[model samples]
Target: MTEFGYFLSSEEHGPQALIEQARMAEQAGFTSLWISDHFHPWTAEQGQSPFVWSVIGALSEAVSLPVQTAVTCPTRRIHPVVTAQAAATSSVMLDGRFRLGVGSGEALNESVLGDEWPEAAVRLEMLEEAVQIMRRLFRGEQVSHRGRHFTVQNARLYTLPGEPVPIDVSAFGPQAAEIAGRIGDGFITMAPVPEAIERFRRSGGGTKPVAAGLKVCWALDRDEAVQTAHRLWASEQLPGELSQILPTPRHIEQANELVTPERVAEHITCGSDADAHAAALREYVDAGFDTVYVNQIGPDQQGFFDFYRTKVLPQLNGA
Candidate 1:
């Protein structure tokens, strides 16, 4: 059965507001939670980047739903060993209901450290190395890796869960998906394309968990929802990693110039009609995702939840 989840937008909501929303999402019967792990918002308009790990800790005390980083880059901004330790600690804190979802990463967030942003192939190579490092560290073994991109000297994690933390690699392109199949316990994506899913399986992944997410604006008014969603998350409509490695918000805004509301709406469901929202999400399930996460864009978040809870989730859940 495909399960429904929600994304906690660290970019739009404050910690208290998001915690309350998470509690409400639990009450409304969401099965899982995925939060953004962005260091910077694509634009100042979206505003807010609370450290996701701290929010996860609070969520551990506030709710029972399992959580995952919609995707975190363990390659550059944070070392894989550190990420492994964090995931281990989070797993224990969440009582073994946490999964680590990682990817090649973007420069917008990583380059902030003053590291030269590498191209796609190099980024993927770094991701491969990072995954090896993370797995070794998760095993609670001493690691002294000297890779081309990263090096760690005799580092051993002191605290880890008794079991290895499950890794879900986030992949969009075919190469990345193949790598995920070769290495990851599961796969995380956004496009939810059947071909990609097939590639993942063909490469070595089986019927393990497959997760994808899409942005939405839900309201009684269609135009308002589209406008709000576009205004807030237009950057997502832009192709590639503006949030992870891009130079500036202006670069994002420039790339997003191609992301018209029409273009975004074609891929994502925006506007007020409950059935439309449900159908939009259904497309992802049809594409082979075992789990679908929905992120509400703009400020009408409570309304987004209410609409999905009362109108959308039931239909998707087979009510």
Candidate 2:
């Protein structure tokens, strides 16, 4: 069966709010959780970026649902050794319910520590090495590695869960999906494009679960929801390599100015219609994703959860 999960947006909420939202998600009949990991918000208007590890720690105590980082970048900004340690601790805290979702990363978050953001090809290469290193450490063994992009010496983790944390790789395009299939325990993506999923399977993804996410705005007023989505998430509408290359929220905001509200409405589900929300999520389910996550674009957390619990999820479940 396909599982529906709530996506906790770290860029738009603080640690406490995120934890509270996780609890709300659990109470709302969702089966799992996906939380974004970022050092910065895509745009300033979104106004928040909490350290995801800290939030995960709190979440382990606050909720019972399984949780995964929708995607974390272990290649830069943080080292794989540290990431493995954090994920191990999280898995133990969550009673073996944690999965480490990772990717090649974006310049928007990875460029903050004076590290030059490498091109996409180089980033993917680094991601492969990083995952290799992380898996080695997850085995509770000491690791020493000297690689093209990173070097580690005598690194070992003491705190570990009973099982090695599963790493799901995030990909956007066919080439990246192929890489993800080669390296990941599962797949993480946003769009419901069957071609990408098929390419991944052909490239070795096989029956490993494919996970996806989408954002929607829920409000009594559709127009108001559209304005809110455009105001806070217009950066999402920026096309091409723009999202991967932009280094700062200001640069993102400048680019997002070109994304009009009409365009935002064109892509995002807005307003109180239960069928619209159910239909949006069903696209991912129909496309063969084993797990689908959804994020509420604005502050109507109660309404979004309530709507899904009472109206949307029932429809999706054919009740």
How would you encode candidate 2's per-residue C-alpha lDDT over 197-226 as one tens digit per residue?
998898999999899999999998999999
lDDT of 1 by residue, 77-162 (tens): 89887888889899999988999999887776777788888988898899889989989988888999898988999999887877
**Worst lDDT window (10 residues) for model 1?**
237-246
In model 1, the Cα lDDT at residue 100 comes to: 92
TM-score of each: 0.95, 0.98
Give lDDT: candidate 2, residue 255. Answer: 92
lDDT of 1: 0.84
**Each prediction's whole-model lDDT (CA):** 0.84, 0.92
Off by over 4 Å in 2: none
Tell how far residue 88 is off in model 1, in angstroms. 0.9
